[model samples]
Target: MSTARWVLHLPAAATSAEGVDRLAQALRDSLRHVPALDFGELTISAEDDQSTRRRVWCDAPLGGDRRCALRTNHPDRCLDR
Candidate 1:
């Protein structure tokens, strides 16, 4: 049987927000040498504030449109709006 694996594409540390590197390293360290699962390419991305307002489109079996506004750092504040 083939082993299951996941690929991750990490963003450049210099361009990404602060603490992204630490977060990536934590994920990498935790996911290493697992029994049934493995991962590759832990990717991070940096986007402008306006970019977050755009919709995200999914392809293939998961085809759909998603709004980025639904995601926020402050969940409590979301309900106030």
Candidate 2:
């Protein structure tokens, strides 16, 4: 069976990429209690250019159906959430 996913567009007042990332992290942290929310697959992109996306989490496989929990482009070893 295939799982369907949806994109949620949230307009933010952040003026830079770092600011937007910070906002995304905050949102994920605040909503972490929601089981349906996938915190490890968070991302952000320019409001006008949806074609270009940036990953917020590593989302790498860690064996036995587990995934990495570190931020994207991290320099250290992968970790589970």
Candidate 3:
């Protein structure tokens, strides 16, 4: 008998949208034990999409703020009509 956990579900069609950002912020804040305890269980999951478009991937810096990297996937094959 183990305790149940909550998760967060995210839309797969997100492309640097505001909703995604709000969710991310809420998630980060939710990680705090005190704050998280205030809310009920939540699910955090990403949608399943076969078609992954070109998006800048950023790392959540421990010191705060996110930065985009130069390296990318399908960089040459992307950016065209």
Q: How does each model score on lDDT?
A: 0.37, 0.83, 0.38
How big is the positional error of residue 30 in model 2, measured in Å on the Cα after superposition? 1.5
lDDT of 3 by residue, 1-81 (tens): 999988544343455455554564464455646543322222223345435433323222324332322223334322211
- Predicted candidate 2 versus true structure: per-residue lDDT over 1-81, tens digit per residue: 999988766657688988988888888778979987887877678878978887989999999968987899899999987
Q: Measured by C-alpha RMSD in angstroms, how accurate is candidate 2?
A: 2.4
TM-score computed on alpha carbons, candidate 2? 0.77
- Count of backbone collisions in candidate 1: 9
Could you arrange the candidates by lDDT from highest to lowest? 2, 3, 1
Better of 1 and 3 by lDDT: 3
Which sections of candidate 1 miss by over 4 Å?
A: 1-16, 35-40, 49-81
TM-score for candidate 1, residues paired by index = 0.31
Best candidate according to TM-score: 2
Worst 10 residues of 2 by lDDT: 5-14
Candidate 1 root-mean-square deviation in Å: 14.3
Clashing residue pairs in candidate 1 are 8-40, 8-41, 8-42, 9-42, 9-43, 10-42, 10-43, 10-44, 11-44
Q: Candidates ranked by TM-score, best first? A: 2, 1, 3
